[model samples]
Target chain A: MISVLLIGKGNIATHLFEAFSNLKEIKVTQINSRELDNIPNADITIIAVSDDAIAEVSNKINNNFVVHTSGSFAMTHLKNKTRKGVFYMLQTFTKNKKVDFSKVPFCLEAEDKNDYQLLEKLAKLLSEHNYNIDSEQRKRLHVAAVFVNNFTNHMYKIGNDICKENNIPFKILGPLIDETASKIKTLSPEKAQTGPAIRNDEETIKNHLNLLSENNKEIYKLLTKSIQNGN
Target chain B: MISVLLIGKGNIATHLFEAFSNLKEIKVTQINSRELDNIPNADITIIAVSDDAIAEVSNKINNNFVVHTSGSFAMTHLKNKTRKGVFYMLQTFTKNKKVDFSKVPFCLEAEDKNDYQLLEKLAKLLSEHNYNIDSEQRKRLHVAAVFVNNFTNHMYKIGNDICKENNIPFKILGPLIDETASKIKTLSPEKAQTGPAIRNDEETIKNHLNLLSENNKEIYKLLTKSIQNGN
Candidate 1:
């Protein structure tokens, strides 16, 4: 059986706890760092703390095969230990939704061959629910995710505000929104791109800016200019 | 029978052609500006051109109840001597897919009461296929659309690019992306917001920024700051 010690009990940690606890041949001992003394010793110590606390949490663990669950960070973040690795799950997770790990990609990294082999075996086991990933590639992916998921969601919020201000039913835009995302699944975004900025329709763009709230107008102009520049 | 003269052969115009052509009382005629002088006179002219071209195209029409199929632009853009209005379809149109405009919102605008009534009748005909919208409401919805449709799609593209750079299958992120958008159906985005930046985890944000490519790093930082600032 693989004994796993999980540190932190927040959103990501909770999911990891639930996932690992449900698996056979895997025993997970979850610990809130605030209550670390209660945690049982284990073969693999997985630190799931915030990035600033990674080094601090890493030093507290005295075990082989210590790892951290973060996509952007390196295995070196766990350098104080003998066995160090990464088990970063590259998917946006929420507490309410049940994610199928089988489709999630686990970005894996380690300091040495033995540790790499051990982490790879664990990753393969997890791969029953996720695809195995590598660090360098995952780093690039993390960046792209920022653009697509985080920034895009923010735009949605902005759009909602616009709708509320204009007495328009935001639901009216739902079908169009779904179609926009669906198109890119089959076409590259560069080809799928449309609208005033891409069309270079200055009049419409100007009119759109005019309709925006003063602050949003600034954001609209910035984004429009960015889109126009093709970045 | 209503003689509907469709101008411009773009995405929106094509969809309008299919929808209006199917109506019992509507006879649709599509004309490209390249062959402008050849078009026959009609009761209604739908100028489904780019926003910048709406004014120019409306000026060329000989005589008719002209309408521009743009949500952002006002009916004033249609400088036609005869009746003028906006027949804006408040939905995103793609070339590959079929859309049912019966429930899709149609924004109606006109100078004269008779012309407005004519559009209202036309809108009622479309209501069988979609929803009816007015000019001011549609403009607000259009701005909101920039966030939901255009901005969100761009974000997905970013996520795809991130996955591509990391040697990870972008498909892995698809389910999560879909869920994020779907969550809003029940919850407001303000309450639904998640991720490292929203948590105010400066360390994670810094690490994520460092993980990105130089250009992407700047984008990540800007967006992270924006989210943090609540913009």
Candidate 2:
């Protein structure tokens, strides 16, 4: 059994805790930075803290296989570590519900081949459902993720608010919302894009704009122009 | 059985054809402009044409309780005609599938009391699984949908492109995407917004900008500024 030590109690760490707890072949222990006395020596020590806390905490742990769980942070952030790597889950995390890490993509980064092999095996176990990625790729992926997930969801929020203001049931847009998401799976977004803006239907665009509040109107104008010019 | 004459063969009409086809209580005769020769005289005629075409088509139909399926276009668009009303489906429709309109929303608008009751009954029947909205409210909702459904989905597309170029599997953002969507159902978008741009994490934001393509960089900057300034 691979013994793992986790440091942190945030969303990602919590999910990791639950996942590791259920794993039959892994023995995992969590360390609270606030109560460092509980920390135990283990085969793998994972620093799943905030980006700012990585270096300070990495320095505290003496000579264990250390890995940090961050996509944006460089692996060198764990400089004091002997067995150094990254165990970044390339997906967002939330606290209330359990995440299916099995399907989640794991971005594994390690300097030594043996360490890489160990993390790879651990990642693969999770990979029965999750994806196994690496640091360099994880950074790129994280950047893209912000665009699709974070930014897109924001747009949905805007849509919901607009519906509420107009007294149109937000449910009216559900199918379109779901379809927009599903289409990207089969087609490149560029190819699947459709709307007054993309069609350059200035009349419809103008009508839609006239209907918008000042703030929404600004967003509408900007996005319309962007999509029209193919930016 | 209600004999319904369905006009237009665009996205909404095509789906309506598929959905209404299975209902035993309703007999639908669909008319694409190309199939105008077969326009059936029936109890009700639903003009499911483009916004610009609503007036022209309403003028062509003679002495039937005619309703145009448009959210933004007011009832006045059908003003000159007798026995006029609006049967707007407040949901987005695509050509590939039939959505369960019972759970969707149907916005009913009519001038005459008896026709209004009939329209309301029809709407109630369809909305057994959907929502019922008033025209004024639906128009407002349609505007909001422009923000949430159309605008948000476009942002997702843009974000996905960023991932594609960066060799990141866009799938990684699925959880975040779903969470963002699900969150707004319970919270206002402005309150739920989280990210480097919102927090003004200058270091991370700068790092992200460096990673983006020139076009995406421009988008990142524009949207980031918009979100930050609440413009």
Highest lDDT model number: 1
Estimate, for each residue in A1-231, the C-alpha lDDT of model 2 and write its tens digit. Answer: 899998898877878888889989999888786666546888788888878788888887774688988878888768664778888776655547557666566777788888887887887767643445666667777677777656765676667667666655566676556656665665666776766777777876777777776866767887877788776
lDDT of 1 by residue, A1-231 (tens): 788888998778888788888889788888887775555778778888876677888877777778898766766756555678887876677777776666666766777777666666666666644445566776666666666666777777887787777676666666666666667777777677777777787867777888776767766776666667766
The C-alpha local distance difference test score for the whole of candidate 2 amounts to: 0.73
Worst 10 residues of 1 chain B by lDDT: B126-135
User: Could you give candidate 2's per-residue lDDT for residues B1-58 as a string of tens digits?
Assistant: 7778888888888887777787887888888755655467887788888887888777
Per-structure clash totals for the candidates: 14, 12
- Classify candidate 2 by CAPRI docking class: medium
Instruction: Please give the C-alpha DockQ score of model 2.
Output: 0.49
Over 4 Å off in model 2, which ranges?
A34-39, A127-129, A168-172, B34-39, B98-103, B123-132, B186-191, B229-231
- Model 1 complex DockQ against the native: 0.49
Q: How good is the docking of model 1, by CAPRI class?
A: medium
TM-score of model 1 (CA atoms): 0.82
**Per-residue alpha-carbon lDDT of model 1 for B1-231, expressed as tens digits?**
778888898888888888888898998889896577776888888888877677887887876688888777777657777777777776777785777776576667777778877877877877743445566777777778877776676667667766766677877666556666776666777767877789887766776776665655655676677788887
